[model samples]
Target: AQTIHQWPVAEIKAVGSPLSLGCTIKGKSSPNLYWYWQATGGTLQQLFYSITVGQVESVVQLNLSASRPKDDQFILSTEKLLLSHSGFYLCAWSPGQYQDTQYFGPGTRLLVL
Candidate 1:
């Protein structure tokens, strides 16, 4: 069985500051990783996804970038922040099969100012 974990940001941050978030998957090698975001009272959207290490694809037009730095770890970051970026971030994974359902792990909430 695979285990996924997301690291949550536990504080508020100002605009223009750098942001970094990460997630890890255990017991599963080379799993399909995904990043999703949802604003307060807004719809959820997929931001990025990766099928292999060192190859990440952007699914949505967000001002953020995601990378699969390790076989079991994924990272999301941005050079600068914006107020509109405030919301919730979720990390998910799937078995990479087209018919496989994606499973959500954990999420982080951001209350930007």
Candidate 2:
């Protein structure tokens, strides 16, 4: 059984401050990972994705960045979050070597102040 975890379920941050959010997967190996964001009442947008280690692709560039330091950990962050950066972020994963369904974990909802 595979499970995903995200931290800071909700946050309120100042516009010029730094931000960090985390996601981790358990019970899955070499999974395909993705980061997605949804603005207030807006549709979800793909931010980044990794098919394997050291290989990440950007689907959309919202002036944000992501990194995968481990097989099961992906991080999304920004040095300065703009007012437009406020949104709900979700981490998702698919089984390795298979085009299986992608599953989203509990997401982090952020509001910029």
Candidate 3:
């Protein structure tokens, strides 16, 4: 059975500080992973996607970065946190194949202070 896990349920950070969030998908190899952010205004935006380990592509311009350091792990990091970056984040994954269904793990809520 495949399971995806995202860490740190929430965070409150000051502006201009660095941040990192991690996700790991077990029982799958080279899963296609995605990072999503939903702002306080209720926009569900996709930030990044990874098709394989060590390769990540940005889907939108959100001033954030993502990487896959392991076949089962994905990381999202930012050098600085912005007020506009405050949002609820979701990490999702799909089997690394065409037309597979995607599933989301419990997310992290970020509040910028």
Candidate 4:
């Protein structure tokens, strides 16, 4: 069975603070990763995705960045947090293609002040 892990279950931060979130997948080899964000009471948005280590693609300009340093590791970070950044961050993995169902991690919740 595959398992996905996300760090810092939740966070509360002030504007301009540095922020970092991470996700790791186990029991899967070279799975694809996708990041998503949802604002308070807002719809979900796809932020970016990674198909391989060191290769990331952006879907929107959220002023945040993502990196996949290891085959099983994905990271999301920003130098300065904005109040608009407050929301839920999700990390999802698909077997080998986008058409496959994505399995999501526990997710990180951020409340930027």
- Residue pairs in clash, model 4: none
The residue-by-residue lDDT of candidate 1 on 1-113, one tens digit each, is: 88888887544778988888889999887789999998878877999989999999999877899989898889988998899888899898888867357888768887668
lDDT (tens digit, per residue) of candidate 4 on 1-113: 99999999999999999999999999999999999998878888999999999999999998899999999999999999998899999999999855678888999999999
Q: State the number of backbone clashes in model 4.
A: 0
User: What tens digits encode model 3's per-residue C-alpha lDDT throughout 31-105?
Assistant: 899999998769778899989888999999878999899888889999998898999999999986785788998
Q: Give the TM-score of candidate 4.
A: 0.95
TM-score, structure 1 vs. true: 0.92
Q: Model 4 Cα displacement at 56 (Å)?
A: 0.2
Candidate no. 2 TM-score? 0.94
What lDDT would each prediction earn against the true structure? 0.85, 0.91, 0.89, 0.94
Off by over 4 Å in 3: none
TM-score of each: 0.92, 0.94, 0.94, 0.95
lDDT score at residue 40, model 4, on the 0-100 scale: 75
- Better candidate number, 2 or 4, judged by TM-score: 4
**In model 3, which residue pairs have backbone atoms overlapping below 3 Å?**
none
